[model samples]
Target: MIDDKTTPCPFLGEMVVMFCQAYPVRKPVPKHLITASNPCAGKGYKGCPFFKDIMAGLGGATGVDPTLASRDRKGVTS
Candidate 1:
């Protein structure tokens, strides 16, 4: 059973990018795949396999920040 009372996954990158940072490498998740099973899409993500796969001792990392990702999409340059 999933717990509806919870915040979304922090491992999820930009709202538009739809990627999972839980993997060893960033995995691209399609918009269509954002179902109840998608922990990043809704609450109760702790039950997700990818979420559970997180290495032990890892904490306080939000992965790709949405603000930075949006800047990247806009073509940030020095």
Candidate 2:
């Protein structure tokens, strides 16, 4: 949560940075990154670097589908 406001673009001073890798273009909004505490939720996913990256399939370092991850966490197996 780098919401210092002094930070530059791509570093919108949010937790999104911790879950994403930088890209030339903006990133995409990751569903997994969306939480009740996220400030961007109300603002939508426009001009968001992390959101753009996720849309381009370059974001989310979790390496696992969020749905699957949740299921796994619950000990649910296919």
Candidate 3:
């Protein structure tokens, strides 16, 4: 079962450690937050700069923005 706190960033290519695919590295980089668990594995994922950049570049994927759907899933009121 999925944990409520583990929102998982879409740019997170792998689950064996917080490997992020938002960078230009040959392989996804392992990320973390010394202050807490990585945001890539939590609701704070929406705050990632890379996530925003990638989502912005995907304008043509669909007329509707994906964040709206995410918010609905998490019951976030915009």
Task: Say which candidate scores most in lDDT.
Answer: 3
- lDDT per residue for candidate 3 within 48-75, as digits (tens), equals 8876765666663545555554444332
lDDT of 1 by residue, 3-66 (tens): 6578667686564446655545556666777887755666776566656545232343457443
RMSD of each: 17.1, 14.1, 14.3
lDDT of 1 at 21: 53
Per-candidate TM-score against the hidden true structure: 0.37, 0.23, 0.41
What's the number of clashes in each of the models? 0, 12, 0
Where does model 2 exceed 4 Å of error? Answer: 1-39, 58-78
Per-candidate Cα lDDT values, in order, are 0.53, 0.48, 0.54
> What is the Cα root-mean-square deviation between model 1 and the actual structure?
17.1
Backbone clash pairs for candidate 3 read none
